[model samples]
Target: MRWAILRELAKGQSLPVVEIAKRLRTAPSAISKHFSVLYHSHIVNNEHGRYRIAPGLLSADRQSLDFGCFLIRLDRLPK
Candidate 1:
């Protein structure tokens, strides 16, 4: 589910919880928990209730995200 969210955000767009839930076919409440973890971990940034991947974390090529522990290749995830 996190991967799915990341995949969507990989487009370099910040989105609100409701929009994310709609894209994932899940309820907003369901994703809020994930957002909390992500926000705390600094994996995503929250601004005015919108979330986006942290800056300078995505590779220059935009093929993957560097979590400082692992690399998540965007193309490998389900669309």
Candidate 2:
């Protein structure tokens, strides 16, 4: 799911939450949670509520680690 989000943003275009939610066939809230994780982890950048792929995140080395690292970070949050 996170990979799908990254792939869609990898096209180098900024997209709003609604558009991403539509493409993923999920509820807006579901996409929002993923987006929040991505944004907080610096895997994606959000500008004025629109998200764009961040620099250096599309490299081959970052492929699967991004989501794994993101999950790790989420676990550390004050839950």
Candidate 3:
């Protein structure tokens, strides 16, 4: 689901919830969970009720956390 969001948002344009759901072939509610998490995690941003990939996330590297996914960090290099 997140991968879909990433792919869609990779187009370098902002999208509203309804359009995003349409592109992804899912219900609005179905994708809302991912949108909320992604927005809160700094992976995505919302403005005027539309969403776009956060610039910081686009420029930064990411690491996977085996636990406590609610935690996100920047300025850390992977070993």
TM-score each candidate.
0.88, 0.70, 0.70
lDDT of 3 by residue, 1-79 (tens): 7777766776677999899999988999988889999888777889998998876555333432222334333224231
lDDT of 1 at 9: 86
- Model 1 Cα RMSD, Å? 1.5
Model 1 C-alpha lDDT per residue in residues 1-79, reported as the tens digit of each score: 9989888888888999999999999999999999999889898999999999999788877779987788889989876
Which run of 10 residues does model 2 get worst, by summed lDDT?
A: 70-79
Best by TM-score: 1
lDDT of every predicted structure (CA atoms): 0.91, 0.72, 0.71
What is the Å distance of residue 56 in model 1 from its true position? 1.1
Q: Please list the residue runs of candidate 1 whose C-alpha ends up more than 4 Å from where it truly belongs after superposition.
A: none
lDDT of 1: 0.91
What order do candidates take by lDDT, descending? Answer: 1, 2, 3
Give Cα distance to truth, residue 61, candidate 1, Å: 3.1
TM-score of 2: 0.70
Per-residue lDDT of model 2, residues 1-79, tens digit only: 7767776676557999999989889898989999999889787898999998776555443333244354322222231
